[model samples]
Target chain A: MSDPLQSWNDGPVKASIVEFVARVTNRGSSDHVPPAERIAVFDNDGTLWCEQPLQVQVFFALDRMKHLARKDPSLAQRQPFKAFLEHDLKTIASLGKRGAFEFAFMTHAGISEEGFDALAHAWLEEALHPKLGRLFKRCVFQPQIELMNYLRDNGFKTFIVSGGGIDLIRAVSEEAYSIPREQVIGSSLKTRVDTQNGILTLIKLSELGTFDDREVKVENIGLHIGRRPIFAFGNSDGDLAMMRYTLAGPGSRLALLLHHDDAAREFAYDRDFKLSPLSEALDKAASYGVRVVSMKRDWGKVFI
Target chain B: MSDPLQSWNDGPVKASIVEFVARVTNRGSSDHVPPAERIAVFDNDGTLWCEQPLQVQVFFALDRMKHLARKDPSLAQRQPFKAFLEHDLKTIASLGKRGAFEFAFMTHAGISEEGFDALAHAWLEEALHPKLGRLFKRCVFQPQIELMNYLRDNGFKTFIVSGGGIDLIRAVSEEAYSIPREQVIGSSLKTRVDTQNGILTLIKLSELGTFDDREVKVENIGLHIGRRPIFAFGNSDGDLAMMRYTLAGPGSRLALLLHHDDAAREFAYDRDFKLSPLSEALDKAASYGVRVVSMKRDWGKVFI
Candidate 1:
């Protein structure tokens, strides 16, 4: 019955996060940061939740492909869709950047804004990962959720900057992370307004827009948030740009990257991971003085 | 020595605006609304500030075009640019929808996020309208500014819903209107991330995104602000969609449209003006029970 946040296993990491947040929030304290400058950004997937086997977005894409394949048999022969149709994880993984981009665009195409939200909500409600056998939402790291709440409680405006689709993350971010829809920035598909039968609808277009990754993440932070973050957390190379951006800011700054090294408690892969590899970023963490949190060394447990 | 807001005209329209704001902000009074429900949105251009001869955005676009034309004369030969180059207001006006769309894209293209904010601030500081000969920031509606503070003092969260560029509005909205940057919603151009040399940059692309007009305003209201506004003010057809959205919310809602009818004090044109015309929307205002304030009959003075 004790508070899970108070007994978080990763005491050192949690304490560092809490202490940094406290210093930033306390105006009277020497480390106090002004309210206008209290910005903290987090990477969603591996840092806050699990992204093993494939990303949540890849799951959404595959699901959409399955649905499309049922309606249009031609999708079964399409490059990425064919791999997805045959359950060829190897082939799909090897499809590389171009194939992945195509899959992402096609799967999310033609969905109405409302329809996409409903679909995301419905999928989260029932869909279970093959490896975890648990709903995607349930797989979220409890400690990270607590950390987000703690930051919010201390007046730090928290945001999720991810490579996932903006609409997809927005659908559940408010409910799951307490991050408002507006505060979530991610890759986006093009959208347009269409009036049909006098009813105006915001329709998802077939064009792909910016992908929130590495350099794009840093650019988006400036574009959308309009301020540099003082604190940033991530778990992969995809987050390197954000970490660099945060560290480059004046005055107090903190960057923490979670290194998955506990195979029993969580999936253990860093440089070898096909998706979201942390190789070069992990190597540079030491030079940048970013705290590289080893899951095995830092945490006494994994989930709540 | 007199207070500008206090010395300004107190006609039926201004009185109504003040009275309605007072009722909503009075916490102990029966008309007091809770902070969660006390939402008020104002149109940016004319309602919150002046938009005569051209909108503030048109000025920014023209300046941007001139700057670009200096660097590349080929740009001056383009459709909108060519019209801009000839200084032919008639031809520019004749180009109409297509011309405006092209101008919006080209004028905003390739500017870095930081550069855009700096440009906006610089222009606002030095640029003066040809006739007004006053800083654009000085042209803001004093009565409305006072009303904004009064509403905030009374617990209402004020927002600026505008048709100007989102970044441009956000740049000056905080200083000019006292509304937070996040509370300002406006038309947005597409942007992407780029890395030049070693520094990361957010570059505005030559793509026209949502115009935040008519129905898109309603859609963006729902997208950006989860809660529906209880009170809204607008001066043109661009705001009809937002007014409709606000009025449809489940509560006591007020929608007011400022009808510019005082030629001496302010430019008066409804159906004739190409920019922000009030033709068809004005006709439907009566059926919707939207309050229409005629500037000539409802106000004693124009600016503070």
Candidate 2:
């Protein structure tokens, strides 16, 4: 068929991405990256889909917390659980990084890995985006999906490196974006394998694992993928470190940040958003030479 | 041109493997596993090569420890260092899991991920297997190499679920087994992203990450691959859990344990290997329905 990224507006952002892929993939070009080294990583929350009101995974976790609380009334008296029960997001946020992680662990842990996978799968299938009026998976950007296909067609191995839970993303990523579970690196909880009644199962534990945010994202890329991605896409400051890491690689590199400047179509807060604040990254894009793709102008259509 | 596993003598072990692969890959067969679910996991140290006297990675780490001691003489008096320096295997062994882990951390950490990659690459390229008298990479089993290629040819994704450090194996696994770095999961040291003097790098920390052996191997398989392997291979009891996990999956599954009963071609030890002891696993193979491939009988040739 025609170029896969044709859904993207005929603009500099699309042009740059196409040109970068062509340059790196050309056999005779000096910028040629071997297929093994052509790793491309994308941030999931805002870059791939809508994460304006709250991250979809967090909402799922909150629902799970309420479900668990119904079984054990004592959970409502606990610190993070109490805050979650009250819908006291400000109080939960005040608890800071450690509190947020503990809350996620309390809600998300204590299940088999497969059980958690099924839970995530069921949630994504049933849950709709409140504002978008569609299933959460359906909120994924059409142009970005096209870009992933375009890159993969050119021999780049595309991966979703998100701040969301790895298990949650792994559930729907393959069906939604053709990105397999192994290629999806993100925050995780500790898991232990148990053979119960001769049945092997991995039980998710109440502990946080490598929090795939900010500097940790770059660290995880090295730990998991073991290769510098030549291409990286993100939408907020949490990805600044990863973008810098990608651009620091010796050969050709492309780093793009999605600017949510389309209030009519999508949410448009940049400097003031608490969850995925884009202030520092937006201000430093010029200094870092990172391409900023505006959601309003760069995409002919947002979602498929 | 011929059947890939030709080095494997025509025996029950060989026949079972071939039949299993054929049944799983056949589209119309009841046991058919789709290409996406055709995951095969292998243990590296003994199953892939020789791990009799010592695991190749442990030897490499010992060498690195001595090298580090040369730089800082104070390390010479440290418990593991003193034991390593004096060739006191008993003292080192007496140090137990925590001590061995500390030794590994001291020797293997404090380098950039790429730097560790280079170190391991250089070691594998230049170092010889003491008794084998061949480059370490060249000591890999010929039949298993053929099996990996054969499985890949049949569209199965083969991975090394090893006890060796992930970075150490990643350096040479691609060339030796054609398994890419990401698919090679193993023990890892904690790492952090560091930007020193404007250069971004992942610095391996002194803390240990997932100690991928025993039940942890199964946990890591679930955590990393997010799929149960349809086929599993191992040579010791450390792999018992992983093999069981693989076999427990639905449809068709194959689990094979390599019995090192060939003292002539290779070392012969099962119950008393100390390091990679094959005691319980070897004894229970029959009851577990795991195929035990005798190295001397099953293979026409050993190393490539």
- Which model scores highest in lDDT? 2
Give per-model TM-scores: 0.78, 0.95
All models, DockQ values?
Answer: 0.24, 0.73
Measured by TM-score, the strongest candidate is 2
Clashes of each: 0, 0
Worst 10 residues of 2 chain A by lDDT: A93-102
Chain A TM-score of candidate 2 vs. true chain A: 0.94
Writing each residue's lDDT as its tens digit, candidate 2 over B56-136 gives 776788778889889999988977788877667677666544356456655877798778888888888798877878887
Candidate 2 has what TM-score? 0.95
Model 1 reaches an interface RMSD of 3.7
Question: Clashes in model 2: which pairs?
Answer: none
How displaced is residue A225 in candidate 2, in Å?
0.9
Q: Cα miss at A296, model 1 (Å)? A: 2.6
